[model samples]
Target chain A: MLFDFEIQGGDFATAGNASSQIKKILKQLNVDHRDIKRIVVALYEAEVNVVAHAFGGKISAEINTTEVRIRLVDEGPGIPDIELAMQQGYSTASPEVREMGFGAGMGLPNMKKNTDEMHITSVVDEGTTVELIFFLNQTPPNH
Target chain B: MIVKEIVEKLNLTVHSGEAGLSREITGGYTSDLLSDVMGNCDAGKIWITLQTHKNVMAIASLKDIAAVILIKDLKPETDMAAQSETEEIPVLGTSLPAFELTGQLYELLK
Candidate 1:
């Protein structure tokens, strides 16, 4: 099944709705709980970025028996430095966003941590797109 | 400890889901940031924060938090309360400031 949602930027009240809906769908689809949790976390983080950082965005999900793919696209000022943004404690979130308990610079890192694979594309004046994939058939590797 | 005791000790008002007061909470995490709460908080911990948004309930649902206490007497909106019911997580309100409530809870749990 496929699901898509438009994520409005700066809409703190509805920020996680897309992820929550995805989580419900995954649960009903009988996706593994661990994998579902990871996907939900990654989706929520990306959703938050779209709201807090992007001008606005859309999230789309494709689900199959073997895997799930989530795409987040936003028309906002693109990241000036992807490497710095990927650092665990680096953030450009405003004080208001931080006050709401986010912007600890963990969003992207957490997204990367939770998903099986992640891809990011951006342009300075244009926008950013983040794609995350979770495989249903593979267990997370043990350390 | 039961949520009721935590509420009483903190002198918080029950915003919704009074029945959840009977539930046991093994630990507590106090934060306004949903991301930290989600990334670090253990399942079933009582979450205390000053944030009274609907998204707080969403985070609680995702993290499986035992319940949410909105510190500083911050009352959640009606929509937020409704969302809590939908998520089956209780939302409690407290007049105590974040620091005071955390201190009290720490002493009680200690």
Candidate 2:
């Protein structure tokens, strides 16, 4: 199954809508509960990141018998230092975003922690794309 | 324990989602950080926090949380309560601070 969602930046009200939809689908598919939890956690973090930082973004989630692949591409101020941004306590979110109990610098790290594989690419003034993959045949690694 | 019992015992005010008052509570998590709660909270837990936004309801629903208790008499944002009703996950409230509410909840669940 393939699903696509459009995300708007600073739209906190709809930030996790995509994740919620994906979660419901996974439950319907009888995906392992633990893996479902991991997938939703990572996806929710990524979705919120787009809302908190980007101008907007699109998410494509593909689920098959063997794996789930999700790609989030956003047009916004791209990360200048991917390594620094991946750090647990680093964030560039504005004061208003922080007031919502987000931008605590945990978003990226939490995504990485929950996914089996995570890849990120960005341009200085352009945008970012994040790809996350989870293999269904294997037991989810303990986090 | 179920959420309705907690509300009765703790004198918590039910703000919305009263339909979920009978949901079972396996545990509880206290945090204001959205990501922290998302990453660490488990299903069937009651969440105690001060965040009033709709995203809090989003997290609660995604995590399958039994209920949300806003500490210090904080009210849920209008949309948050609406979503709570939609999701059937009770949004509850109290005048007690998080520490006190958690302490009392811990005693009840323990």
Candidate 3:
């Protein structure tokens, strides 16, 4: 199954809408509880990234029998330093965002920690695309 | 312990989602950062934070948390309460700081 959701920038109110829908679908599909938790964590962080930093974005989630692939494309003031952004405690969120308890600089790092495979690409003045892949129906890995 | 018992013992005020009081509390996590809780908090845990935004409820629901306790007498945003009702996750409040409340909850659950 494939699903798409729109993300509006600077809109903290609806930040988790996409994650919420995806979570419901995963539960209905009877995805393993551990995998579902990781998926939701990664996706929710990505969704919040778009809401907190981008102009707007779209999320495409595709679920197959063995895995789930999610792509988040955003129009925003793109990250100039992908490596730095991936580091924990690195963020450029506005003061207003920080005040809301969301800009603690853990989003991307958490995203990487939860996904099985991830890729990110961005243009300084244009946008960013983040891909997260998770292999499903597998025994939980020791963490 | 169940969420209902926690409320009674802690004197937490129920701000929304009374139906969820019956839920079980397996553990507790205290963090003001949304990503901190989202990334690390386990399911069925009770969250203690000062964040009152509507997205807090979103995380609480998605994470399958038993309940949320807003610290320092902070109240949920208008839409936050509504979302808690829809998600059936109770939002509780206390005048205690996050530190005090967290320690108390930890002692109770342990």
Candidate 4:
């Protein structure tokens, strides 16, 4: 199955729509409970990154019998230093955003921790793209 | 323990999502940052936070959190409450602050 979702920047009200929808679909497909949790966490962080930093972005997810791959591409001021941005305490979110309990610098690291394989690419002043993969075959939901 | 028992123990107000009052509560987490909760909170745990936005509900649903406890008597926004209803994740409120509420909750759960 393939799912595509568009994210609007600064739209906190609707930010998690895509993640929520994807969760339902994953459940319907009988994805393992553990895998669904990991995938949903990674996907929600990616969606929030777009809403917090980019003007807009698109998420493409491909789910097969064995694994799920997600790609998030955003248009905005891309990250100049991916390594620093991945740090546990690093964040560039606005004060207002922070007040709402976001932008604590754990987003990328969490995404990486939840996925089996993850890659990130960004260009300053241009855009950013992130790829996350989760292997669903290793441990079934009930395992 | 289930959410309704905690509600009785802590004197928390059921702001919305009464349908979820019976959900089991395995644990509790307190964080103002959404990412912290997302990365750290376990499923079926109750989330204790001060955020009163709609995104909080989104995170609760995504993480499969049993319920949300709003601090300092903070109330959920209109739409946030609506989402709680739709998602069937109760958004409970309390006049006690985060620290005190969490302490009592931890004691009960422990």
The DockQ leader among the candidates is 4
The C-alpha TM-scores of every prediction are: 0.87, 0.97, 0.97, 0.96
Q: Tens digit of lDDT per residue, candidate 4, span A11-113? A: 9999989999999999999988888988999999999999999999999999998999999999999999998998988999998888888988999999989
Q: Global lDDT of each model?
A: 0.86, 0.94, 0.93, 0.93
Error in Å for residue B103 of model 1: 5.1
After superposing candidate 2 on the true structure, give the runs of residues whose Cα lies further than 4 Å from its correct spot. Answer: A140-143
Cα lDDT tens digits, model 2, B30-105, are 9999989998999999999999999999999888999999999899999999999999999999999999999999
Report clash pairs, candidate 4: A101-B34
- Docking tier of model 1: it is medium
Prediction 1 global C-alpha lDDT = 0.86
TM-score for chain A of every candidate model?
0.95, 0.95, 0.96, 0.96
Instruction: Evaluate model 4 with DockQ and give the value.
Output: 0.92
For model 4, how does the per-residue alpha-carbon lDDT over B63-109 read when each residue is reduced to its tens digit? 98999999997999999999999999999999999899999999999
Q: Report the candidate with higher TM-score, 1 versus 4.
A: 4
Per-residue lDDT of candidate 3, residues A38-82 (tens digit): 999999999999998899999999998899999999999999999
Q: Every model's DockQ, to 2 decimals?
A: 0.64, 0.90, 0.90, 0.92
> Tens digits of per-residue lDDT for model 3 on B4-60?
999999999999999999999999999988888898889899999988889899999
lDDT of 1 by residue, A21-72 (tens): 9988988989888788788888898999999998899888999999999999
DockQ winner between candidates 1 and 2: 2
> TM-score for the first chain of model 2?
0.95
